[model samples]
Target: MTESPSVITKRADFLAANRGLRVARPGFVLLAQPNDGKGKRYGITVTKKIGNAVVRNRMKRRFRELLRAQLPVRGLPDHDHVLIGRDGGIERAFARLAEELDDALARAAAGKGDPRRRRPARGNRR
Candidate 1:
């Protein structure tokens, strides 16, 4: 099923949790990080090294689609995500994006421990 906006978290939340997923190829890096405890929100990072707005947008679109269709199914539903687009060939193929996304999500999900658990307060420290 498609992920609801409420289920997507933002970038800040993911960073705060110290949870990240990355799959790198010669052309791009696919990354997914959990945001808030609500839903999945995403950010796309493409440097000038890739291309202009047109090219960058294209890459972003690819990543967006990959995440929209497959990411929620594979990775954590409650996380923030950032997909960095590479240059040359990696920018062109959709399958490559799909494959890398799958791999990255798998890697991120491999660690199943919860990051939200609270530690004992200083008063309880012994």
Candidate 2:
């Protein structure tokens, strides 16, 4: 299908949605927040911890493809979503990636608000 209608291009948008609901899966972490915008927008982030520049770019590409394929059918319109790639994201099969994305979106939409689903804060060790 054609590329998703809108993309989250501005840094402000990302910051604005930072406190939104989150869904974490083995492959990726999804942050979703409601927006007043017209259509769905998305962003992908792959941190250096995941790998070097090439690896990060590859992860972003995979996330982009997932968004393009799934957003139209399963994404929430008027919402902003950011997909953060994790260590296994690149190595995971595309089909499984898509499946996880679908499940994450569904959970986000349902607003289940599972406290256990959140990622634990990193603790400093002396």
Candidate 3:
């Protein structure tokens, strides 16, 4: 299922709740976090260090495409995730970022803290 833009969590909320999920390499850092809601939502954060507007926008576009292709298959839901692009992002190959995202999602799924842990209770707990 695709996440609609309307459901995307605002920046303020993301900062307050996302504890962060990090994967580091010599060239860059990938930080992801769980959003406190249903269906997976994503945002991108590229700083000046990454490059000027042209570079930043390109990075965001790459992250968006890779994430869209890499996520829904795993059934991630109601989570707000942010990918912070590091310096030299413009030069990072598209496939590399996609692979990193796939790996990161695998890591998230393996952990108990994965935002997918929450499913609306189907019945009365009592």
Candidate 4:
């Protein structure tokens, strides 16, 4: 029987996943990394930048469904998967998001991940 992927709840887990492979699509960014044989685990984050609480919750729900459907079979085994919502993701078609996720997973499996994005420097505090 196929078990549903486990949810990632710890803050450290999310931070660690950020250091792994990154695959950016128009809708969202996929981050995957080995979890020391912790099995298939996943997390979803929708920022306030995306919208109000209602919008963010909606986005999270959609992301959760996408992960549930795809992660068990298509996701990388023994890896932690994190999906960071993007502005376009809230309105993107579910099928298209699924397609992008599949493509992202393929690239990640082949070790063909996008370059890590550099964080901008924060302005000096007064």
Candidate 5:
């Protein structure tokens, strides 16, 4: 797929729409929210905690491919989706990853009640 149709290129956009809905699976975590514009925009986030730069980049690549293949069909219109890669993402089979993404999207869209879905408390640790 072309870059313009499948990517969410701005940090501000990601954060502003961050409060929508989330779905977690063993392979990845998906955060999705309604967008103000048309089409589906996506972002992939692989944190340093997953691995070194090389490993992180590999996971991001996997996510990009998965999104490219699945998003157009499974994704909702005018929504921004951020795919957070988990350590297992790199190892999981592509088919399984796609299945997980399908399930996550469905659950997120259905607005399943997620008990652990609240923001953390803010306070001084010390």
Candidate 6:
């Protein structure tokens, strides 16, 4: 029997996945990492920077649908997948987003991820 992808709800899991391979597209970023023989797991994150609650929720819904449809069959086995929303994602076409995801997954599978992004220096904050 085929097992469906599991949902990732813990903050630690998200953070751990952040250290894994990253594939960035115009709409969203896909992060995938091996989970020590665990079944496939995934998470969706849509920050307020993307939009108001309604907009953020809408993006999450769309992402959830995309992952549900693609992750089980194409996702990396025993890996954790996280989808980080981008401002462009909310306005992009679903079909286009789907295509991008497929491309991203293929890249991840082939271990051809984008270079890690540099983090800006943090100054003192109030």
Return the top candidate by lDDT. 6
RMSD of 4: 1.9
- Per-candidate clashes, comma-separated: 15, 0, 5, 0, 0, 0
| lDDT (tens digit, per residue) of candidate 1 on 1-126 | 676433224555535444455555565555556554657666667778787888788777777777678755775777666666677634457887677667666766775322443679989977
Every candidate's lDDT: 0.62, 0.85, 0.61, 0.93, 0.80, 0.95
True-structure lDDT of candidate 6: 0.95
Model 1 weakest 10-residue run by lDDT: 5-14
Question: What are the runs in model 1 whose C-alpha is more than 4 Å off?
Answer: 5-21, 89-91, 112-126
Models, CA RMSD each: 9.2, 3.0, 11.3, 1.9, 2.8, 1.7
Q: Tell me how far candidate 3 lies from the true structure as C-alpha RMSD in angstroms.
A: 11.3
lDDT per residue, candidate 4, 12-100, as tens digits? Answer: 99999999999999999999999999999999998898999999999899889999998888899999999999999988999999999
- Higher-TM-score candidate among 1 and 3? 3
User: Best candidate per TM-score, number?
Assistant: 6
Better of 3 and 4 by lDDT: 4
Q: Per-residue lDDT tens digits of candidate 5, residues 1-126?
A: 533446888898778556778788888888888888757889988888898999899888888888887778777778898988887888899889989988987887687724546555677333
Over 8-105, each residue of candidate 6 has an lDDT whose tens digit, in order, gives: 98999999999999999999999999999888999999998898999999999999999999998899999999999998999999999999999999
Query: Which regions of candidate 3 deviate over 4 angstroms?
Result: 1-9, 25-32, 112-126
TM-score of 4: 0.94
What's the CA error at residue 48 for candidate 5, in Å?
Answer: 0.4
Tell me each candidate's TM-score: 0.66, 0.86, 0.69, 0.94, 0.84, 0.94
| TM-score winner, 5 or 6 | 6
Model 3, poorest ten-residue lDDT window? 110-119
> How many residue pairs clash in model 2?
0
lDDT: worst 10-residue window of model 2: 112-121
Query: What overall lDDT, based on C-alpha atoms, would model 4 receive against the true structure?
Result: 0.93
12-97 in candidate 3: lDDT tens per residue?
75574346655553224544556555456666677887777888888778877776676667435655556667776667787776
